[model samples]
Target: MTRTLRVFRWSPGEAERTREYRVEAARDTTVLDALVEVQRSQDPTLAFRYACRVGMCGSCAVVVNGRERWACRTRLGDLGAGAVRVRPLYHFPLLRDLVVDLGPHAERLRRALGAFTPRAGAEPYARIAGDSRERAAIDEAIECIGCGMCVSACTLVAPNPRFPGPAALNRALTLQLDSRDGAGAARWGVLLGEDALARCHGQGTCTEVCPMGLQPTASIIRLRWLGLSRLLRWTG
Candidate 1:
């Protein structure tokens, strides 16, 4: 079967435009596969990113038909015979065709102290209980692949660019619940900042778009409750 892919294209100084390419697709043909065919045969200039075609790397994430999805995992047959509209993830600077600069997403993670800071001078190979509350709290959220889809889907990001997006906040929650993480007060300071946890409106769009099925909205809510409890303990 033939499918039309309406892909967004742009260069450094070029005006943004959508270019359509028709490609032969099988039931198992993925958006990434079609894109590869387009780049190989249809248009050599078409640009996009994909590392692991099996969807583990999260590098192939893009906006598909108005939703964030991993192009490598999106089957053309699943799109229901409509022209597949492919665009770079929203809330990010467009770098080129189907590629967006991920620097902002990284910066947000950095600002949220997303990196795990081990307890200083702690013993190597410290073990955590598998059934502990901390482990349970982060089990679902710990698998985040750092794809910028949640950030792109977040409604608060465009209006408030300072907000450390859902992915970052979700990472923060994981670290905050980690018994081995020494970020502690410093991490909490960032989490409770004017543009951090409070900025999240709990819209769940992040949860909806997360390619990893992580619940960032629930993480944010957990962080909010933890923050409030910490504050009350200090005052009580």
Candidate 2:
């Protein structure tokens, strides 16, 4: 069967336009596969990034039919039959046809102090129990692939560029729970900044669009609770 792909095409300082290409593909063909076919036979100038063709790399993410998804995992069968509208992930600066700049999101993660710092006298991981509370608390957050999907789906990031967005907050939550982490105070300071977690309106868009099944909204709520507790302690 044949399908039409209306892909967004643009570059730095270039007028944006949508180019439609029709290709033959099976219903089971992945969007990435179809794109590869289009590039091979249709347009050689099309630009997009994909590493693992499986869902692990998180590099082939795009806005498909008004939703953010990994092209490798999203099957043409699932989209039904029609022109598939493909665009770069929203809430990010478009670099080209289907690529967006992820550097901003990475910068936010860095500003959030999303690194781990072991506390004094902390035992090595070999000595720490696998089922310990600290490990359990961060298990889900560690599953994030840094795809920037959460950041793109986040409503706050579009309006408030300074908001750290879900991915960064999720990273902060993981580090915040680390009993060995000695940067809790500093991390909290960043999360409590005027343009940080408080700007999150609990839209849950980030959680819904997360392909990793991670609940970033829940993490933000937990961070809010932690922030409140700290405020109370400071006041008392």
Candidate 3:
């Protein structure tokens, strides 16, 4: 059961380094469990983040073997007997080993007008039909759990900081599609900005790495089409 875990080690005001830990773990054990074991038995200073170890909270996301995954849900057995390399999610400020600051991602969402604003004077008990288009649209884009995996997987964020990443754009799409949301046109306007939706470039990495099964690529395409249609209407 002995395994070699190469964990990225860093702290504020220090150069980043990789520290390898030898730990005994079962084959079915998750990477997060192995990390916890390493921290408990070998090194107490190892820093990582996890909540709801059953994978619901999405806080345990890390880069394992060069791909983003939920550390809590990724089994060592699935990796097939190779050294495991764990690092914080990419494209965010690394706080320490396997932990990154999510503040910038949240702020990007805020700048993109991702919040839901209810329509003025809308009835509190408005009934939405199960088969309605708005209901379907909302359901399509509302499942993001804010794991920041999509943001890490998106390469566009590296050069274009203003690009609101997949999660924020997905949130904007959900709000844009909701009939009850008051920020519909304004949200679209924000998304149409130079550093916003057009920067996505139709890369499927976000969709591929999303643990929640959300298709951010498709959402971006839909939003762009809507934005273009609106622009045409205005110009015509």
Candidate 4:
């Protein structure tokens, strides 16, 4: 059985026209597989990025049939119809077909001081109890692959790129709950600033789109609660 792919493509530095590629595919082939065929057989200039075809890397995220998904995991049959629409992730600078530059997202994660930084009397990484509340909190959020599917779903990131989005805030939340991290106050300060936590509108689409089954909306909710707590404490 042959399937047809309706791939949305726009070459970099070419904004005047968008290119559509219709290609034949096998029933067992995924959209990413069909895309590779189109690129290899006809257009060598097509650009996208993927490291693992097994969906572990999370680098193959694309908009297929109006939903954000891991291309490697999305089979042709999953699309059902003969046509599957493929495009770059939304709310970011499109680098090319099915690819968006995530530099700004990376920068925001850095600004949050994403990794663990300890206080003077903090226990060693090995000393931290596996079943501790902070450990459990961080464990749940640690599965994120930074695929930006949540970013694509977020309406706020469209208007405000400064908002940390789900991935970064999830990263921040993980660190905030770390038992050894002396940086909670500092992390919250950056995350709660005008351009950061204050900007989330709670659309909850980020939770809906995450492939890892993580609830970033919950993290953002916790963040909002923390921010309000701090405000109350300060005002008192």
TM-score of 3: 0.96
Better of 1 and 2 by TM-score: 1
Ranking by TM-score: 1, 3, 2, 4
lDDT of 2 by residue, 1-236 (tens): 88889999998788999999988888789999989998888789899999999789899999999999999999988997789999999988888999999999888888899877877677766334679877887787779999988887888887887788899999899888777788999888899889888899998999999999999999999999989999899999
Specify the highest-TM-score model's number: 1
Off by over 4 Å in 3: none
Model 3, 43-75: lDDT tens digits are 999999998999899999999999999999999
TM-score of each: 0.97, 0.95, 0.96, 0.89
Best by lDDT: 1
Q: Hey, what RMSD does candidate 1 come out at?
A: 1.1
Give the distance in Å from residue 226's predicted Cα in candidate 3 to where it truly belongs.
0.8
| Model 4 per-residue lDDT tens digits across residues 112-184 | 7877787777656545577876677667778998888998888888777677778888888877766677888
Model 1: runs farther than 4 Å from truth? Answer: none
Q: How many steric overlaps are in each model, in order?
A: 0, 0, 0, 0
TM-score of structure candidate 4: 0.89
Ranked by lDDT from best down, the candidates are 1, 3, 2, 4
Predictions in order: lDDT: 0.92, 0.89, 0.89, 0.80
Indicate the TM-score of model 1. Answer: 0.97
